[model samples]
Target: MSFSLFRASVRRAATAPRAQLRSQLRIPLRKFSTPPPEAPVPTPKSNTTLYVGIGAVVAAAGVAFYSFSDSGSNAVKTGVQAAKVKANFVPTKEDYQKVYSRIAGIFDDAGDYDDGSYAPIILRLAWHSSGTYDKESKTGGSNYATMRFAPESQHGANAGLNVARDLMENIKKEFSWISYGDLWTLGGVAAVQEMNGPKIPWRPGRVDGVQTQATPDGRLPDASQGSDHLRKIFGRMGFNDQEIVALSGGHAVGRCHSNRSGFDGPWTFSPTTMTNDFFKLLFDEKWVWKKWNGPKQLEDKGTQSLMMLPTDYVLVQDKIFKKHARAYADDEALFFKDFAASCAKLFELGVPTEQWVSPEPWIMKNVDEK
Candidate 1:
């Protein structure tokens, strides 16, 4: 306890191994503890364990620095970005509504296109894409969006649909996650709703399929064909007489082009709007063979400007078909109801039931709907 003794004790403590001093102080040693000199220095065998412990601590410190430090943040951010890339994208109804809004915005942007609205042709694209479904083979239809490929795109019935496909491609770019099948079918739904037509219930589930899945040509109805052909084409699609008459009312909007279907002219006076007019005009008009070089289409003797395809005329000529057509022509509300139901079925033709995002299809709201 004397000054000289205390000085000697302090010198010994300082000179002794720091581990021994720490033990005297009752301090706990961690995993990488240093032994007192009298315990014998660690051998090369033990040095391996000591070096591994030091390396592990250094590695843990480096990870913490990378996670928290500004300079190391870029690496951390890159890892997060990679994780995001790997995660699957699932779109909600709101997401699909944004896509619908974009499609609706473009419908009226057509400068000189038919009726000054892209709605008709866009609807046609949707129809032709889905109409290819043959229930027997279970091939084609909107499920694959095979119209994006060859052979099918060049099918006679699909002529001029390129305009619609190209227009929808812009939408696909904005919503890169949406499948082409969903995009084209949704495009059809948008066209109908925007043109003051019936609401088509829709949901997204179609995935793109390979080109080899495309249906054979002539699956779509030939405009020049008569009632039996109509029965055959639509009947193959699983439609009964009433569904056939209702679906044909889609002609109430779009026209036949000589350059496209080899028949030219609009089915109704208002080609831009959806109405019972197609059925009405078919009954009201005096349709005679057109005096044209292109094909055997009928022009109304009254106007000469408006025309009808043989297929359109047959809805009135065939007795069974005439009954349904008469009902649609007499009652606009009935036409709207039938068309909405049939078109919804048409759009969803080849899509598997399991692929549907919901058990019940969503009624996508129109742009004007609050």
Candidate 2:
């Protein structure tokens, strides 16, 4: 009986009521073989936030640098204190005229220097100084007053300019601020206008320069050469046929000294006034070769009194150049305008940008006005 009862009890224990066995094991019925879901890792979003913060810091730094640089540049530009110019520093048309009169006075007093007057050579000085510009390269212009320097002052074409410059020194003593660049150009204008030429629109922007700025002397036209040589030389300085003819009109005022350019006499009868006489004489006169021991310059066959350089003769020979010369011969006004414009440009070569006042052109008056 005991064995049977024990066996029954063991069976009852082994296969006890499921609820009772669950309670004893303390395990839930749903906990069979499924795996538990993992808790999500806490990945940070800080990488993107860090990048944005760094970018903002870099942008702020860049803005700060640009502001500093611009302010420094502005300070430099404004530092000249150009505002402090003295009351007497201001110019008047009369002042310009005085300068012109001074130049004219020198021309009148030609008996003071070499071979009588130095007016002709002074004209050459202004011509050579301005004739070296090349527009394409922007290398030359009256801006720098480079003719004050050595190689430029010593140029063969400029051989006699020193005498003229020396003569003008007296005028400089009276008006120290007017740069030599301005004086040379103004002198040319004065000589032309007083001689009955058109009123040139002159200005005073060229600053006097040191010897280092003097341009090489050969920059001017060679009186002994033909049209091809003239073109090459003037072309280097940026003159077209029209400009060349206009510039040649300067011959209307001054004479070609036998001792200077090796040609003798003035082209026009009235060598002191600006006129169409140069073209008139070129067209009206019968130009024959001068038979002197001097260079091969042309002489007026009718009078045997006036002369023309080979370069001057080419003006009539070239069809294009001849057209303007004939026009100027007929109309003094056109010659005046052209000569003034071209000559003004010539005087401004190599000028510095900063020294330029407003970059606008102004009229320069003669001495009577001063």
**Which numbered prediction scores highest in TM-score against the true structure?**
1
RMSD of each: 31.2, 44.3
lDDT of 1 at 270: 61
Best by lDDT: 1
User: After superposition, which runs of candidate 2 have C-alpha atoms over 4 Å from their true positions?
Assistant: 1-107, 111-122, 136-140, 352-354, 368-370
- Model 2 lDDT, residue 55, Cα: 32
For residues 51-114, could you state the per-residue lDDT of candidate 1 as single tens digits?
Answer: 3332333234334434544334433432332232234223566667778888888876665565
lDDT of 2 by residue, 23-78 (tens): 65462322112122222223323333332332333233334433443335322222
**Residue 212, candidate 2: C-alpha displacement in angstroms:** 3.2
lDDT minimum window of 10 residues, candidate 1: 1-10
Error of 1 at 314 (Å): 1.0
C-alpha lDDT score of every prediction, in listed order: 0.69, 0.56
**Which residue pairs clash within candidate 1?**
none
